[model samples]
Target chain A: METILKVKNLKKYFGRVKAIDGVSFEVEKGEILGFLGPNGAGKTTTIRCLLDFIRPSNGEIEIFGYSSRNPDFYKSRSKIGYLIAGSNLVEQWTGYDHLSYQEALHGESKIKNELIKKFSFDPKPKVKNLSTGNRQKLGLIMTLMSEPEFLVMDEPTASLDPILQEEFYKIIRKLSSEGVTVFMSSHNLAEVEKVCSKVAMIKSGKLITVQKISALEGKKIHSVKITFSEKVSKDLLVDKNTEIQEEIPNGFELSVKGEMDAFIKKIAKLKIESISIMQANLEEIFLEFYKK
Target chain B: MIAIIKRALRDRFIPFISYSIGGIVLVWMYIALLPSVQQSQVQLQDVMKAMPEGLMKALGVSGVNLASLEALLAMKQYNMIWPLLMIFFIVSFAGGMIAGEVENRTIEIVLSSAKSRAKIFFSKYLSGIIYLILFVVATTLCAIPMAKLYGYEYAAPNYYTLMYLSLCFGLAVYGLSILFSSLFSSRGKVYGISGILFVAMYVLFILVSLKDSLKNLQYISFFYYYNINDALIHNKIDGLSVFVFLSIGLIASLLALIIFLDRDFAV
Candidate 1:
C-alpha cells in the first residue's frame, strides 16, 4: 500500500509539558487506521502537527510526500478533511453558512444537495442554537462534503448519539471503500473495532503498539463453557495453560488464550454434551492492552 | 487576498456604518449650533471661560484665531469629532479582529484554508483602510453643506487637509491595535492593552502641554502628528509628522504580519 502520511520522531511541547514525545507512525492509502489512547495522551497534538496548525518542536511530517514545515505546505492540506476533537464553529453563522464558507475555501463550490442532506442538519439554524449532537453533525458535514483523499478526525463520534454514531460509521465505511484514507483518534474501542483494520495504541505521548486487527484478534481472550454428561474431576481439568475460571456442578467455565484447539480436544475426551465459546469484547481487549 | 477582504467587509459593514453615520451627524450638529452660540454674546464668553486650560491644551487648541467662524469649526470638527471617531472605530474594530477569531475558534477553520497568514493579515489591513477611506469621504460630504451654511471661506482646503491628517493618524492607531490583537489571544486582554496604551499616550500629551519640563513626551503620541490649527485653518501640511506617522503604521503592520505568520493559532 502507498503511504499517505509519514512522521519521524514527532515531538511537541506545551510550556514544560511534553505533550508528544518521539512518536512515529505512517498512514497508508485506503486504510482505516485507529489511533487509540487515553485522555490527554497527545492524540490532538499529533493531529494538530499533521495539519500544520501547530509546529513540532522536534520532528518532521510528510503529507502526500510534501514537507509540512514549508510555507506552501498548506496547498496539500486542502486535499485533507479534518474534524478536530472539539466542535469549533462560528456561533453567529448558520450551519449552512459554515459549510458554504468551508466549501468556498476548498474551491469545491458545487457540492451536491444529497451530500448536505446525508447528515440531517438544519442549515437555517445558527450554530449556537444547535445541540452538541447537531453541532457535531455540522462538523461532520463540513469534513465529509469535500470528499477529500484523507480524513483526520479526533474523537469524531464523542458527542454523537448511538444511532448517529452508527450512521457516521456507515459514512466512514463508505469512504474507506472508495479508497480514502482515514486516521481517527478515539477512545471508543467498539467504534474503532467496527471500522478500523489497523490500530495504534498510545500512552502518555508514547506509542505502545501498532498491529493489524488480525494480530489483535489472536490475542483476544475467550470464555469457554463446557458441560459434561458426568461430573468431571477438578484435578484432571487443572491445567496451567488454560485457566479454569469457575466450576459448576455439571459444567466448567475456562478463560483460554492463544489457540484453543488442544483445549477443546481435552474437553471432547471428557464426554462433553454442550460447549460455547465467546470472544472478548473490544473494551476487554483495550484494558488488556493497557495492562501490558 | 481578495477573498479575505470580501469576508472582512461583509462582517464589518454594520460597525462601519454606525461609526461613520454617528460621526457625521454629531459633527454636523456641532457645526450648525456653533453659529447660534456665537450670535448670543452671553453663551460665547461663558462657554470660553468654562473651558479649562488643561482641557484646551489636551484638545490641541492654542494660538488659533477663535474669533473666526472657520477657526472654531475647524477646532470642533478636527480636534473633537475626528479623533474620537477614529479612536473608537479603529480600536473597537481591530481589538475584535484576531481576538474574536480565537474566542470563536474560527481561526482554525480560517488557517486551515488555502490562504497563508500573510495574505490574511494583508487582507484585514486592507479592509481597515477601505473603512477609513469611506469614513473620510462620508465626513467630507456631510461637512460640505455645513461649511457653506456657516460662511466659512477656504472650507474645501481646510477640511481636505484635516481629512488627510485624520486618515494618517487613524491608520497609525489601527496598525497599533492590529499588533495588539496579534500579540494576545484573549479579547479582553487585547482591548485592555490597546485602550490603556491609547489613554496613556493621550495623558502624556496633556502632561507635555501643562509643563515645559514634560515637553519631551509630546513626540510619543500619534496625536502630535496633527497640528489642527495649521492643518485645518492655515491649510499647511507637516511633511515630517506625516512621514513619522506613516512610518510607524507601516513598520507596526509589517511586524504584526511577521508575528502572525510564526505564531500558532491557539484554537
Candidate 2:
C-alpha cells in the first residue's frame, strides 16, 4: 500500500511545555489508523501539525507525497477532510447555511443527502437549537461532503448516538473499501477495534506502539478457565509461564502465554474438574497496551 | 476566496444599507441646518467664548472659520462625526474578521477548505475594501443634492484627495484592528484593545491640536493624517499624511497575514 501520510520525528513545544515530543508514525493509503490516547496526550496537537494549521517545532511531514512544511502545501491539503472535536459552529446560522457555505468553497458534496437522511436530520434549525448529536451529524456531513481522499477526524464519535455511531462505522467501512485514507483519534476502544485495522497507541505525547489488530490476535496468548475440585493455592498455580487474570470461587482464570504445555500438564495433575481454553481477544491485548 | 467574499457580502448587505442611508441623512441634516446656524453665528461665537476650552477643542471649534460654510460643516460633521461613524463601522468589521471565527470555532471549518490561510485573509480583506469603497461612493453620491439644496455656495471638495485619504484612513484603522484580531482568539479582546487604542489615539490627536507640549506626538496618531477637514475645506492634499496612513495600513495588513499563517487555532 502507498503511504498517504508520514510524520518523522514530529515535535511541538509551547513555551517549554512539550505538547508532542518526537512523535512519529506513518499512515498507509486506504487504511483507517486509530490514534488512541488518554485525554491531553497530544492527539489534537498532532492533528493540527498534520493539517498544517500549526507549525511543528521540529521534524517533517509529508501528506500525499508533498512536504507539509512547504509554502504551497495547502494547494494539496485542500483535498483533506476533517471534523474537529467539540467544534462550536456559528449559532445564528442554520445547519443548511453552514453546510452550504463550506460546500461553496470545497465544491459539491457527493453524500449530502444520503448522510443527512441517514442521520434523520433537517438542516433548517438554528445551530444553537440542535442537540449535540445532531450538531455532530452536521459536522460529519460537512467533513464527508467533499468526498475527500484523505480524512482526519478528532473524537468523531464522542457526540454521536449509538445508532449514528453504528451508521458512522458503516460509512467509514464503505469509504475505506473505496480506497480512502483515514487517520482518526478516539477514546472509544470498541469502535476503534471494530473499524481500525491498525491502532497507534500514544502516551505522554509519544508514539508508544503501532500494531495491527489481527497481528496482535495471532500472539500465543490464551484465556484458560479451570474449575478445581479442591482449593488450589495461588502461589502453586502461578508459574513463570502463566499469570492469574482473575480469582473465582474455587476457580482461577489464567492467562497462559507461549510455551504453556508444561504449565497445562501440571494443571491437569491437580484437582481439575473441567478446563476450557479461549483465544485472547483484542480488548484484552489493547488493555495491556493502554495501561502501559 | 470567492466563497469568503460571497459570505461576507451576504452578511454585510443590511449593514451597508443602514450605514449608507444613515450617512446620507446625517450629512444632509447637518448641511440642511447650516443656514440657521450661520444666522446665529454672532450669538454662537459669543456662546463659544463662554464655553470651556476643552469642550470647544473636542468639537474642533478653535480652528474653524465659523463664517464659512465649509468650516462649519467640517466642525460639525466632516472632522468629528463622519470619521467617528466610519471608525464605528470599520472597527466592528475588523474586530470580527478573524477573531470572530476563532471565538465561534468556525475557522476550523473554513480552514479545512481548499483555500490557504493567505487566501482566506486576502479574501476577507478584499471584501472589506470593496465595502469601504462602495460605502464612500454611496455617501459621496448621496451628498450631492443635499449640498446643492443647503449650501449652494459651499466650496467644492477635492474629490481626488478626499477619496484617497478617506480610503487610506479606513484601511489604516481596519488594518490595525485586523492585526489585533490576528493576535487573539477572543473577539471581545479584539474589540476591547482596538476600540481603546482608537479612542486613545484620537485623544492624542486632540492633545496635539490643543496643547503645545503634546504637538510632537501628532505623527503617531492616525487622526493626525486623517485631516479630512483641511482636505475638503482648504484644498490641502497633504501628500505626506496620505502616505503615512497608506503605509501603516499596508504594513499592518501584511503583518496580520504573516502572523496568521502559522498561528494555531488551539480549540
Candidate 3:
C-alpha cells in the first residue's frame, strides 16, 4: 500500500509546554485515520505541523514524498485540503466571495456547487451574519470542494448538527471509497467509530495507541445486568476480567471485559427472570485509557 | 499571486477610497484659503517675524515669503497634517496585511492554498506599495489640477517634486509598518510600535528644530529627510534625502520579507 502521509517522531514545543512530544504515525492511501484525543491533547498542533502551518521543533513530516520543509512540499499541498474548528472566514466577505477567492487560488472546484447544495448553505450571506453551524458548513464545503486526494481536518464536523454530521460522514465515506486519504482529529467517539478505519488515540501530548477499529472492538468492555426470581450469590458469575460493579436487591450489575463466553455460560444456568448485556462504546474504552 | 493581491486590495478598498477623498478635500480646503492668506501676507509676515524663530522653524515656515503659493501650501498642508494622515493610512494598510491576518486567525485560511509563503508575502507587500503609489499621487500630485480649478497658477514642477518626496517618505513608513507587522502577531502591536516610533521621529524633528545641539541628531529622523519646504519652494529633490528614504524602505521591506518567510505562524 502507498504511504500517503508519514510523520516520524514529530515534536513541537511552545517554551516549556510540549504540545506534541515525539509522536509518529502514518496513513496509507485511501485510509481514513481518526485522531482521537481530549482537549489540549495536541491534536490541532499535530495537524498544523502536518500542513506546514506550524513547524515542528523536531522530526519530519512527509506528504506525497516531499518533506514539509522542502520547496516541493508546496506542490503536494495543491492536492491536500484542510479544515479547522471554527474556521476564520473573512467577516466582511460573502460566502460567494470566499468561493470565488478559493477558485482563484486552487482553480475551479468540480464539486463546489454539489457540496454547497448538500450542506444546504446559502452562498450570499456575509460570514459574520451566518450561524455557527452554517459557518462550519461553509468551511466543510471549502475543504472538500476541490476533491483533494488527501484531507487533514481538525474537528471538521465540530459545529454540525447530528443530521449534517451524518451527511458529512457519508461524503467522507464516498471520498474514501474513491481513494482519498484522510487524517481527522475529533473528540466525537461515535463519529470516529462510524467513519474511521483505524484510530490513533493521544493523551497529554503522547500517542497511547493506534489500532484497527476491529482490534478496538475486540477489546470492548461489556456491562451486564441480571435479575433473578430467586437470589443468587454474586460470586457465581465472577471470573477473570469480570467484576461485580454493584449488588442489587435481586441481582448484580457486572462489568465484563473481553470475551464473555464463560460469563454467559454461567448466567445461562441461573438467570430466572431477566438478563441484559450492553457493549461498551469507544467513549468507554477511551475513558478507561484516560483513567490510566 | 494575483488573487492574493486582489483580495488584499479588495479588503482595503473602502479605506483606500476614504483616504484619497479625504486628502483631496483637505488640499482643496487649503487651496480655497490660499487667496485670503495671500491678501494678508504682509500681516502674516509681521506675525511670523514676531514669533520665535525656533517656533517658526519647527513649523517648517521659518524665513520664507508667505506670498508664494508654494510656501503657503507647504507650510499649511504638507508640514505636518498631510504626513500624519499619510502615515496613519500606511500603518493601517501594511499592518493589516500580515499581522492583522494572524491576529484574526484568517492566515490559516490564506495559507490553506498551495501558494508559497514568499508569493503571499510579496503579493501583500506589493499591493501595499501599489496603494502607497496611488495614495501619494492622489494626495500630493492632485494638487496641480486642484490648483488649476481655483485659477491659481501653481508651479507644476514643484508639486511633482513634492510627490516624489511624499512617495519616498511613504515607502519608508510602509516598510516600517510591514516590518512591525511581520514581527508581531497582533495588529494593535504593529500599530502601537510603529505609531510610537514615527511619533518619536516627529518629536525629534521638532526638538532638533528648537535646539541647536539636537540639530545634529536630526538625520536619524525620517521627518528630517521629508523636506517639503525645500521640495516645494526651491523645486529641488535632495539626492541624500531620496537615497536615505529609499534605502530604509528597501532594507526594511526586504527584512520584513525575510522574517515573514522564516518565522512560524503559531496562530
- Among these predictions, the greatest TM-score belongs to 3
Per-prediction DockQ, in order? 0.47, 0.58, 0.64
Task: Candidate 1: give the clashing pairs.
Answer: none
Error of 1 at B124 (Å): 2.5
Tens digit per residue, CA lDDT, model 3, B25-58 = 9888988888899899889999888987877987
Candidate 3 local lDDT, A169-255, one digit each (tens): 998999999999999999989889999999999988889888888888877699888889977887777777888889877988988
DockQ of candidate 1 compared with the true complex? 0.47
lDDT by residue (A1-292, candidate 1, tens digit) is: 8899888899998889998999998989988899999998888888888887778999889888878777787776777888843357877778777777787677664554665677777789998899998888888878877778999998999889988898889988988988999999999888889989889888888888878777786685888888889878867766765778898779888877667787777776788888899997666667767866
Candidate 1, superposed: residue stretches over 4 Å from native: A84-87, A220-279, B41-55, B67-70, B149-154
Q: Please list the residue runs of candidate 3 whose C-alpha ends up more than 4 Å from where it truly belongs after superposition.
A: A84-87, A224-278
- Lowest lDDT sum, 10 consecutive residues, model 3 chain A, at A82-91
Best candidate, DockQ: 3
Better candidate number, 2 or 3, judged by TM-score: 3
Residue A260, candidate 2: alpha-carbon lDDT: 67
**Superposition error at A176 for model 2 (Å):** 1.3
Q: State the lDDT of candidate 2 residue by residue for B1-267, as single tens digits.
A: 888998887877778788878877887887777778879899989988987685576566765668765667667766767787788777677767788887777777777776878888898888888888887766644555667775556655554456667777888888888888888888889888887888898889877666878878978888777776666666787888878888888999899998898788764
Indicate the TM-score of model 1. Answer: 0.87
1 or 3, greater by lDDT: 3
CAPRI classification of candidate 3: medium
